[model samples]
Target chain A: MNATLTLTKLDVLRVRRNTRYLILAIAMPAVLYIAVGNSTKQTSGVEFKAYYMLAMATYGAFAGALMNNAARISTERKTGWTRQLQLTPLPGGGYVFSKIVASLVTTIPSVVVVFVLGGTVFHVHMDAWKWVVIALVLWLTSMVFVSLAVAIGYRFDPDATQPAVMLVFFPMAILGGLWFPLEGTLEKIGKWFPTYQAHKLGTDIISTGRISMESVGIIAGWAVVFAALAVVSYRSAQEQ
Target chain B: MSPDTRTPNGAVVEFENVSKTFASPKGPVHAVNGLSMSMQAGQTIAFLGPNGAGKSTSLNMLLGLSRPDSGRVALFGGSASDAIKRGMVGAMLQSGGLMSEVTVREQVQLWAKLHPRPIPVAEALKRANIADLADRRVDKLSGGQQQRVQFAMAIIGDSPLIVLDEPTTGMDVENRQAFWATMRERALEGKTVLFATHYLDEADQFAERVIVINKGRLLADGTAAQIKASAGAKRLSFRLPGVADADLYRLPNLVHVERQADVVRLQTSDSDATLYALLDAGYRPADIEIQALGLEQAFLAITAEDNNHGAGAGAGTGIGNLEAAR
Candidate 1:
């Protein structure tokens, strides 16, 4: 337990110290939210600012799990940092847990940026309970994609993993209603994706102001499957 | 059983009939073939071999990075797994194995966290002689400096055993000497060190025992003097006066003799005995020099002789052609 905490702290420090990426992670999603949200003049029943704000929040959470996690892991493995960690007394579980914690930490700032911008610019209305629920759903959704990113990163070398992560991430973002709401043909396809389940559960809880057991079940199922796969793939990679 | 047998202090590391085979596209390549040897604690043992001699494979097994196909590898009278958990072993592999973005101090502290009780970060940096470079990023540092940081990470826990695989590969002559001094200091402090290097002179300077491997087999294992005595051939060179260079082969105990221009070089095992026999045979020539064989010569003699015998055995079969191809 001590080893795990130490490793997790180091992982957080690494992510925190990388200033350029941290800036980009926060700026990209919030900038997208503001630019797109203001360009639309119509209140359009659902406030444009609130809708894009929620979408970008989900985007930030997804990026933390997918792009940021994958890149960091693949680069570390390629540079032999993973092997150095393996040589230590730290258990394999500790290393993976540290990565998850680091991803979660990175996701938090982006979440705050989205919420603050939403409240100030869009004047979006949500009670304290609703905000808390949205935050919880966002945190839980981050875990599923983070596990998938880790699995891909461990299974492939940096050169291959980066492109592979981008390939998977962009499709999920588009299909899961980041760019626009999943409608018509895309909505049918999006329902099958883990990201879709994550966004669906998140949007349902935030907009409906109620937690649905069905959405929770779907998100929970995806998290379990991805986390299990990540663990197995990581163990196999360590043996290699 | 005697206390020595049950808890041996001499052999800090022992490999009993250890073997490792890796799968290749062609077939299974035997990296290590049933090798057994032991080294006393506080001794600096050099593992010398040519490329593909399974030096890295054997080191990996000892470090618990890979398991042997058969037999056992024990460290401090315990298995590799047990030794690893005890934090009794430190390693500097061929790869520097450091995070590129992290500063020197951060990397040291991260690894230091692995031990239950570890040396302070300042002390480990000071020991590696890289205290000044503590704030420098790993990728920003020179290869030698990065190597120093890696060395620091390895030794931060004060592990009793240090395994260095070609640790001085990217280092300059001065840095190499400095690194050797550090390693010598560690050994002097009663820490066992297993260093694998293709550089025989470096091994000769520091290793108390030299283990030479060739084609996945242990060719020789002993002290420098003992290995030289067993496998090293003495060389007697002289400028022949009017005698044909080819005629030097007639000298007794001369396994092979070579003539270049007016000088004849005779390689034999017994330099003193051969010198006397040569003088008694009325072969007294100007500038006769009987030189003691160095570690390089000893390594070549053992591995070359082994290959020769192996080739000789496989001559009748088509495998001899494959061996020659290799």
Candidate 2:
């Protein structure tokens, strides 16, 4: 097998082995959608089920990607497996890119599981394009989480990875209004967050049926910033 | 084993006046300084050094993990990185390099994937004597078992050069013996092997050429017999009822003499001549035993001299003086 496929297989196996992480990533969003989102009838001229389905899917994507990728990197770093890989024929760029792809792939199940729960259990109605857009938006915006995970994996020690991830993921989810629609001070604060902008891109597709260029730009800007940080962190870690 | 005396024909690995220094809170630590050596293809060399002797640093430089502050290191007639990129060198570092989550089979397979041409995973596992444990999780394996898994990973690529830093650190007596048995087979297959080890016996028994380093300095580089010969003395211990230490020192070829209780010990360049002279002088010695010093004693003497010389010069002393001794 090729290096890319082989590495992806290894990572996918790891993801499959850690079923607890997958359950947590998938279940939290679904439970939040059912309990908090089930009672609501409508929001901003959109059905509550549809609006919050995007919210739950956004939360699941970000959580799943960061949880698995960042944790895996931290474990690899602690074990010095990354250093071992450096001595191999695999190029550094290929290792990083493979890891990114692997992490993205691992999180795909979370988006799918949550969306399926939304459509089947919550009985949300949407056009096929709407489903495609929400999935695409969730996947694309989750790149920010991938870069963030890479940075965290390099910067933090293994013992601190879980708490550090929790510290970042929970705050980002809450601030982005992924649990419910933001209003007043929460909305004002949430508007500045990259997650909020990303989540907004998904919800706007349903509420207005129109793409938001400003939100896309904001998400892209955040991704660029995090990607730069990831590079810097990875380099500095290698020096140690 | 006798020194092969066949110098490796092609230089597969070379270090040219390499120097590296690290900054610590106390001051700058010169880890390796102006070191030069080369390994010929098919040569199994043991790189021996005391703790903090810069063996790992030298190996790291040769492996391309760290760049030297000065000089150059080449593998397979090119840069170390290029050789590694070509999959010509396989290395097993001291520790912290194995992943704990995967099964032994998966770990080895993962490493195999990194190389352009890797040996069959089953072949590597069997060679390392871990075929039975291939399905076991790495975290569940013992330290020795994990080491074999690492060994499997290192040789999985069928690389021409294999470098191991203290490969037997955690292995038991039987395991270490088995490990060298595998290594000997590799050496017979014409693989150039370099390993750093604290076991002098391993160097004496396995390595055709031994390189000794102390405090970032190359102390000695030769076969084991040559190293022992360079110490230039044999120890002759005997019970001489009435012999004075002064009389023993006065004998020709005797370098030093000591008396403890009723026994006298002689350090001599020529044990035969010294014994003949002592017997001729009418010294009736009992329980006499002449011993040629081994590599361990030679290594201690060499490093001891370094310590004494380094003490007077303080911390800034480089490997300049030791090169003459080699």
Candidate 3:
């Protein structure tokens, strides 16, 4: 347990230093929110700033969570870091466990940066309890992408992981109304995506002060599927 | 433990009839073939082999990173992973990767924390001669410096069994000396050190025992001097300008003879007898030099002899000849 935690600590430290992750997960979202978050217009029965706050937070959280961990895992596997760790006293699952824990920790800054920007710069006001619940929900749902990242990372080599991540994630982001709220046929089709559902969970909380179980169910379903995929790929990769 | 460290020694490592095969485009490749060896506690053994000689495959199985198709690999009387978990084995692999962003101190410290009974991180750093580079990011360092960091990580645990695969691959001369000095200290402290190296001189100088493998089989196992002796160990060379090729060929104990211009070179099992035979012929060879052939020549001679004898049997693999890796 101590060894696992020590590895997790080092992993988290390295994640903090990763510039690309910071730019994708924290900087990009913060910039997007500042550019279009404030207006007299309302979105989903709330101020545009408040709605966009949740969108960017969700975007940042999942983006950082996926991009940071997936690339690192692929590169580490290619470089034999995973093989090196096998020689240590660390348990068989410790390396992946630490990576997951580090993702959970590092993705926080992405969510928090966008949240703080929304509150301070764009003046998105809400009850303290609402803020806490929304942040927690956004944080928890991002694990869906974290698991997807692991599955993709383990399935592909380092060279292929970059394009794989972009191809799968960019569409999910665009179709999910994360860049802007969706309506009509787009919104209806987008609702099936985990990213869309994750964003809806946040918006549902803000608009109605209560969350929909359907959105929760869709996100949770993807989480389970991806986590299973992660385990299978990780095991098969080790065999190679 | 200290008293029992010397021979009549307990076995620190045991590999009994192990074999592994990998399926390649060319069909099943025998990476290791019914190989067997054992190491006594407290021996500094060098594993010498030509490329594709199953050195890495054997090490991987011994460290429990991979499984063998048959037979067994044991460390400290148990499974390799158990021994490793008990803080009994420390290893540095040629293919192992270091964490990219961490400083040397943090990386070594993390290793220290991973082991159940690690030596102090500072002590490990000093022993590896990388204390000055402690603040530098590990990936930012040169290849040699990164190798030192790997060295520090390996020794931080202070395990009784130290396994290094090509440990000095990128090190410069000065650091290589320091690395060996530290390894010698560990050997003196009764640790079992098994290392694989491409540099035969390192095997010649540092290993008390050398095990040479070719085509996934043990070719020779002995002290460096003993192996050298078995390979017609010395080169007797001189500028005997007027000497005929026939006259040089008649030198007693000559295993091979070659000439460059007026200079003559002879590989001989007994340098003294060969020199006497030359002198008795009344040819005073000028600037005569009888240099003992180093492990490189000895290793080549051993492997080349094995490949020739087995050529008919092992040619189907398309990798019949040993690479004699430089």
Candidate 4:
């Protein structure tokens, strides 16, 4: 357990050392939310900032999980760092778990940035309990995407994994109602995608002031499935 | 334990009928062909082979990074995998498996945590002769410095067995000599050192026992002197201008002779006899030298003989030639 925590801390420190990336991670979603939130007019029965805040928060969490956790792991494997770890007493499970925890830790600042900017600039309103639920839902949703990223990254080589991750990342963000609001035919299609369900759950928790057990169950189910697949893919990759 | 401490004249690492095959586009490619050999504890053994000779594959199997298709690889009298868990083994493979983003200290610390009890960071740095560069990032170091860092990581745990594969790839003669000095010191401290290198001279100078593999088979296994004696050929050179071919060839036990403008070289099985024959033949040459066969010559002879014989009938594996060489 201590080894796992140490490894996770080291990974987080490595990410923090990248000044440009760190700044972008903290600022990008917040900037996008503010710029788009203020310019867009209010929607029927919902304020624009409130909608933008939730979507951008979801985007921030997903990006942090995918880019930080998966991309870094693929690069480590390419450089044979994973093989080095295998030779040590550090278990394979600890390595993967550390990556997940580090991704979650990095996603925190990004989520906070969106909330702070939205609350101050766009007048988004939420009680303490509702805010807590939104944060938990966003984190859980990020876990699912992080697992997916790990699976895809380990399945492909470093050279191919990047383009492959982007291929999945952009579609999920745009089509799954992360970049914009989904309604009518789009909403129906978005419901089929996991990211959309994640974003929907987050928005519902914050705006409706209630937790939907069904959406939470769906997101948790996807997380478990993706995490299992990631473990299998990573182990198979070691053999190859 | 002193690095040079021998393992009580017995096997510390053993491989029994080990064969590893990988699926290729054409068919199954045999990487390790039923290789069986054992290394005594505290003995510095050199595993010499050409490219694709399965040297890396053999080391990988011992490290538990790869498994043999059929056979047992045991380390420290236990399964290879279990040995790895016990932290009884250390390795420096061909590629330096390091994280570029971390500083040297951080990297070393990470590995240190894996061992139940590891040497202090300062002590490890001092031992590896890289104390001053502890805080520097790995990528910032020179090739030799990077190698030193890798070496530091290998010994920090103070494991009983240290396996180094091409550890001196990038070092110059000075650094190579320094590295060898450290290796000898480690061996003297009763640690078993198993290393693989292309430099025959390095192997001859350091390793007590040398194991040569070619085409996925062990070609030779013995002390450097034993290998040289078994091959039975010595190199004789002289700076003799205008020496007649007949006179040079007439030397006793001279299997072959070559003459350049001002130098003549002879391949002989008996250096003492050849020296006496050269003087008896009335040849007065400057800087006359008779050199004993080294590991390089012995290795060449063994591998060449294996190639000529092809795969032997035993188990349809190439390692039969290895046993013959031994």
Candidate 5:
């Protein structure tokens, strides 16, 4: 087997066994979907239930990916496991790539639970292709936050990562309009954020059959920037 | 020996005039001076040093975790990084790096998969003497068992060169013995082994060659017997009721004298001459006793020198003084 594949498998195995991560990624989103998503009525010429469901699902996927990756990386950094891996044939790039893949794998449960709840209970109506597009867009855009999570892992000690994740994640979740509907100046600010773009892309696909090229471009741009930062941080992390 | 004195072949590890300095809160600290040494394939070498004696710094260079400020560190005729990429070296660092949540088996298996041709997981566990604890979580294990797990991780690869730093730190007497037995088994398979240890007796019992360092400078490079041969003084004591301490101190090459009741003890550079002088002084040879110092005392006496190697000239002079003092 390829080295990266082996690493990915090991990472997946470890991530699956982490109960705290599973709860954080899946249960929190499920509870949020049930609590806030139940009372929403139609708004903005779209069913409010569907809009809030898509927004929360996108938030769950993005937050799950970032927090899981950051927690793993920061723990490894604290334990000096990163330095131990450096003594092996495993390349730095391979280790980071494995973390990204693990983050993506772990976040799937969050997205699935949200979608299942939304479709079964709320009766979110959409074509098969629309559903696939929304899921795919959300999953793909979550990669942007994966890199940002990696940067956080490299920049801070393990103890600081939990607060750092909360500090960065909640504001983005709020400003990105995952909770309440964006309006006025808040919506204007949220327009430039990747989380807002991702949620809009998912909800837009459900409302309208067409996809936005501008949103795709913006998400890709953020992914590239985060990827660059991750690389820089990983290289200089130990020096600091 | 000088760097130029190294053998041309079969030298699996080499350090040529390597020096490293680190910037500390107190100023620049020289962790390793211009030190040179090499180990042949199948050689088990022990690096002996006191605290802050550059042992860990040198091992870090060999493991490619840190680069030397000057000169080169090579393994298998290539740079340390190249050798590491080729999966030729396995190491057990002093810091405990195992994941607390993972079982011993899972951790060892993960590390085994990282190498190109790792040994069997079962075999690694058995050799490291942790097979019974394989199913146990790392955090639940005692400190000695965790050290054994770390050892298992290091040897799982079956690499040609094995480097360990203070590998037996938390081990009990039984575990320590088992650890060295496993190390001996690996060496018998023609693997090159280098370990840094504070236990001079462990070095004497296990290592074929010992390298002593102090104040970031190379103090002595020889076998245990050879290092012991370099000790400054040996004690020659006798139950002489009438021999005065001043008379024993007057013996040639005598460094110090002690008197306790009816016995007189003389510390001398040349025990034979001192004994003959004492015999000539009318003390019968039957009452005299000479005691050879162990490696521990010899190590302490050698490294306690005030030889500070400041410039490039200092290291050579310090080592030279070491040899002369011997």
Candidate 6:
């Protein structure tokens, strides 16, 4: 356990040092929110600033969950770092366990950064408990992408993982209404993505004090599918 | 009785009829086939084999990186994973990878913290000769520099059993010397060291025991001199003009028969028997000379014999070709 934690710490430190992760998962969302926070637009029955704040926070968490881990996991396997760890005192599943823990830890910074920007500079207000709940909802639902990252990392090589992540990233960010509020055909399609549902869960909490079963069901369904993919790919990679 | 008789007291490593077959488009490749061997504590063993001769596959099974198809690979009288979880083994694999984005110091430090009882990180770094590159990012270093960093990580745990696969592959002469010196220090401390290397001379000088495998089976296992002896210890040459190839091939214990015109060279397990057979045949060959074979020549002779004899055919011959010196 100590060894796994040490690996976890090292992994977190490595992610923190990655400039690409910072630019994509942390800076981009915060910058985008600041540029569009004060628009005269309403989304999901909440103030434009508050809704956009939730969307950007979800954006940060979602992107943070996917980008760093996918590239790092694929690269580690290719380089034999995973095999190196297996020869250690660390137990089975220790490498993947540490990676997941590190991914969770690294995503915290983005969530906090976006939330603070929204609550302070953008003047979006909410109850203390509401802030905590919304943050938890967005962060927890982003785990779908964490599992997806693991799947992609195991399925592709390091060079391919970048394009693979980008393939998922653009569709989720745009179709999920993270960059802007979606309506008509876009909303109908985007409502099914975990990212869109997670953002809706947060906005509906602020506006209606409740989230729909459909939103919860969509996130949970995607979570199961991605988690299954992660397990299958992880096992296959180990066998090889 | 003693947790299986094969694991005698103080056996640091053991392989019992283990086999592993990998399936490819070409068909199933038997990477390891019923290979069995064991090592005692404090012995420095060199594992030698040709390319695709199951050296890496066996190492992987021993390190618990992959499972054997049949039988068992035991480390310290238990499973490989068990021994590893106890931090009883430290290995530097040929394909084992180093972490990027971390400095050499940080990388070695992380390795030390992962084991049960690790030596000081500074001691490991200095011994591996990477102390000067401590702050340099691992991915930014040269291939040789990265190999040194791996060496440091392998020794950081100070485990009782150390396994190194081609530990000095990218090293210069001086660095190779230093690397062997540190390995000698480890051996002197009563640790069991198993290494596979391409430098046959290093094995001749460093290994207290040499084990050679070919085509997924134990070909030869003994001291370097003993293996040389097994593969016809001496080379005998004589100018026997007009000597029939059949006549030379008839020599007792003949390992190889080579002829260059009137000059006949015979590698024989027993030089005396081979020479007397020629003389006994009423042939007084002029300028008779017998020369001892080096480990390299002996290795070539033995493995070549096996290759010509076929994979399973060499089972009776035990014959390690060690073409790439394992």
Highest-scoring model, TM-score: 3
Interface RMSD, in order shown: 1.7, 1.5, 0.8, 1.4, 1.8, 0.8
Sliding window of 10 residues with minimal summed lDDT for model 2 chain B: B316-325
lDDT of 4 by residue, B233-313 (tens): 588898987778777777787555677888887767688888888788787889888777767776666565566567542
RMSD of each candidate relative to the true structure: 4.1, 5.0, 3.2, 4.9, 5.1, 3.5
lDDT of 6 by residue, A210-234 (tens): 8789999999999999999999999
Candidate 2, residue B4: Cα displacement in angstroms equals 26
- Candidate with more favorable, higher TM-score: 1 or 3: 3
Tens digits of per-residue lDDT for model 2, B221-261: 99999987875548888987767767777788755567888
| Candidate 4 per-residue C-alpha lDDT over A57-142 given as tens digits, one digit per residue, 9 for 90 to 100 | 88878887887666777877877778777777676688888888888888888888898887787778878777777877787678
lDDT of 1 at A113: 88
lDDT (10s digit) by residue, model 1, range B1-326: 12332234567789999999999997788889999988777778999876777888998888777889999998778777677677777888875467756788988988888875688999899888899999988778988888888889778878878888888777788878878888888888888889998677898889998998877778888888888788646888888667754445555666456778878787777767777766777776788898888887766666666766785333232223224423
Model 3: per-residue Cα lDDT at residue A183 = 88
Candidate 4 docks with a DockQ of 0.63
**Candidate 4 segments whose C-alpha is farther than 4 A from its true place:** A43-45, B1-10, B237-264, B271-289, B311-326
Q: Report the Cα lDDT for residue A125, model 5.
A: 80
Summarize candidate 6's per-residue lDDT along B1-326 as a digit string, tens digits: 12332256778888999999999897788889999999998899999877778999999999988899999888888888888988888999878899888999999999999998899999999999999999999999999999999999999998888999999998999999999999999999988899998888899899999998888889899999999888887999999888888888888988888889999888888999999999999899999999998876777677767777783543333234343233
**Candidate 1 chain B, run of 10 with poorest lDDT:** B313-322
Whole-model lDDT per candidate: 0.77, 0.81, 0.87, 0.78, 0.81, 0.87
Give per-residue CA lDDT, model 5, range A1-240, as digits (tens): 366677787788777887877677778778888887876587544688788877877877888788888887898878878778887888757878898887778777778888888899988888988877788888878889999999899988889998998998898888888888889999998877888888888777777776788777877888889899888888888554
Clashing residue pairs in candidate 2, if any? none
Could you give candidate 3's per-residue lDDT for residues A2-73 as a string of tens digits?
999999999999988978777888899999899988787888778888878888998999888888788989
Q: Which stretches of candidate 5 lie over 4 Å from their true place?
A: A238-240, B1-8, B233-269, B272-289, B306-326
- Flag clash pairs in model 5: none
